[model samples]
Target: MKISIITVCYNSDATLEKTILSVGGQTYKNIEHIIVDGLSSDNTVKIIQKHQDKIAHWISEPDKGLYDAMNKGIEMATGDIVGILNSDDTFFSKAVLSEIALFHTKNTIDASVGNIIQHKADGKVVRAYSSKYWKPEKLKIGFMPPHPSIFFRRTLFNTLGFYELGFIIGADYELITRFFLKANISWKYSGITTTAMLVGGLSSSGSSSYQLITTEIQKALTMNGLYFSPFKIKMRFAWKIIGFLKK
Candidate 1:
């Protein structure tokens, strides 16, 4: 099956090239790469043009934010399966796409979820997140499949609709929980380390980022018809701490 890999960025010149190369170097040739830039002032556009042949479709213009640009990529995609690999992230290896394709053929998966390695500046993994532990009930406690590592059937978006534009930073947390619990979608974990994300991005940087994300996770859970006490969110935090220790 053809897969559409979308990369959304804004002034991401430093890491965008590697992200492009990761997709272009994939072993699977049927994949399409769609890039959506938010009117970057830097040389990001020039870099994209430099590798224009590898890109199937791209746009550089004004947009809302990360999630908004992602939504635009979703709208432009024309493949059987859709996956997002942010400008700051890359596929773990050239075989990543081939593995995802195999997961779809061998399993009844509407969405293929994988793992992500969030690394520090020196390339040491800070936390390794795998979808093997994710469950529908975990949504209430703030667990989600790593956003960049999951691939959805393009038709899933047609049925579930786009990301909520109202949320600027934390909409993805909501989208993940909504897909698993409220919509009752079919999904499975490939257990493959699909993407490697660097440290100090929107959700990974700063001291208060975790608090802000947890708040948004609670917000998404509430909006998706699953409300839990403050204790439930705390339990989620506890789980994450255990995961961090194990890693």
Candidate 2:
């Protein structure tokens, strides 16, 4: 099956090359690389032009934001399966795509996800966030598969629609909840490493991370028809605090 991998970027010249090389080095040959750049002022456009021949389709134009760029990439995608890899992230290994293809061929799954390792800006591995084996109860407590580690059949979008542009920080979380929890799609856990993500990503760290988490959990519960009492909301906030402490 052909896979279309989308990389969204802004002023990311410093880290874009790593993501480019990672996608270019994939063992699966029937793969298409699509890039949507937000008209960066840095050398990001130059870097993209340097590797233009290897990339299938790319556009360096101003966009609304991250989710808008991703939506554009989804529209441009022509592969049987679709996945997104952020500019600051890379595949865990060259065989990652090949393994994904093999897994899809063996099982009938609408989506497949794996583990992700968070790395520092200096290229230091911080911690590994492993996805829980898929379960409805776990999802109620704010469990979700990392977006970078997920590969889903493109038809999922045709059925359920793309990420909601309304969400700035929690759209991915909302999308995953809609697909896995609400729709009850056939998804599989690869139980293997998939992507290495930078630690300081929007939803991973910093002051805004708390807001993102709370919004995501609230949205997830609401969308799934699960009512969260005041106590439950506080419990979820406490969990976020514990997670930040561990980080």
Candidate 3:
């Protein structure tokens, strides 16, 4: 099965090359690497040009935001399965895509979620986030599998629609909730470490982002007709702390 992996970036020159190399090194051969750049002023486009041979489709232009760029990538994707990898992130191993392909080929599911490890600029591991404990019911508590580790069949997007452009931080939350709870899409845990993410991204930055996401999560849950409570959402942080401790 072909897998289309999308990488979105703006001024991501320092890290984009590694992300490209990770995808290029994948053991799975039938892969389509799509790059969506927000008209980066830096050397991000140059890096993309450097690895142009590895990419199947790419575009450099101004966009609304992250989700908008992702929507563009999704529109260009023609593979059987679609996945997103941030420009600052890389696959855990060359076998990562292979694992995803095998998992999908074996299991008749519409989507899959794996695991991710978050790290700092110095490469210090923060926590190992797993999808093993995730269930559709957990959306009420604002918990979700690592976004970078999730992959969906292209048909899911066609059936459910792309990421909602209305959200700033909760577009992914809204999309996941729509797929799992609202639309009742089939998904399974892949039991593999798919991506390694850099810390300090929008959702992982600090208190301000946390507060904003908390508010947006409420908005997302409400829009989906799911129950929402600020108290329940805050408890997700406690669960995160426990996961870090266990890690």
Candidate 4:
């Protein structure tokens, strides 16, 4: 199956080249690389244009925000499978897409996901978040596959729709909740490393981290057709603390 990998960027000249080269160097030949730039003031568009020959489709224009650019890329994607690789992240290896293709072909999976290595700016390993074996109920407690490590059938969008633009920070989590909890799509865990995300991302860098997690939990519950219970939310926070302590 052909895979469409979309990278969204804005003023990411410093690290965008690495992301582009990583995808261009992939062993998988049946992949399309689409870059959506947000009219960057820096040399981001120039950098993307420099490799335009290898890029399947690219556009540099003003967008509402990150998710808006992502939605634009989704509209331009023409593949059986779709994935996203942010400007600050890279595939784990040259064979990453090849491995994903093989796993999906053998298992007939609608979605494939694996682990993610969170790295500091200096490239030091900060932590590894292993997606728990997929379970609908576990999601209530803030369990989700790393967004960048997920590759799923493109048709899912035709049915479930794109990321909710209303959510600024927790849209990806809400999208996953809708897919796994509401639609009940069959997803497989690859048990392999998929992507390395640079630290200081949206959720980890700012004082908004706390608000993001809280909003994520609320959105997850709402999307799953569940009502939020103050007690349950407190318990979820408590469970997170326990997990952090164990680590």
**Candidate 3's residue-wise lDDT over 1-247, tens digit each?**
9999999999999999999999999989999999999999999999999999999999999999999999999999999999999999999999999989999999999899989999988999998888898898888888978899999999898879999999988899999999999999999999989999988888877899989898888888898898767797977889778877996
RMSD of each: 1.7, 2.8, 1.6, 1.9
Tell me which of candidates 3 and 4 scores higher on TM-score.
Answer: 3
Best by TM-score: 3
lDDT, candidate 4, 46-100, per-residue tens: 8998988779999988998888888899889998889999998999889999988
TM-score of each: 0.94, 0.91, 0.96, 0.93
After superposition, which runs of candidate 3 have C-alpha atoms over 4 Å from their true positions? 239-247
Candidate 4, poorest ten consecutive residues by summed lDDT: 227-236
Overall local distance difference test of candidate 2: 0.84
Shift of residue 241 alpha carbon in model 2, Å: 9.8
Ranking by TM-score: 3, 1, 4, 2
Clashes by residue pair, model 2: none
Error of 2 at 186 (Å): 0.4
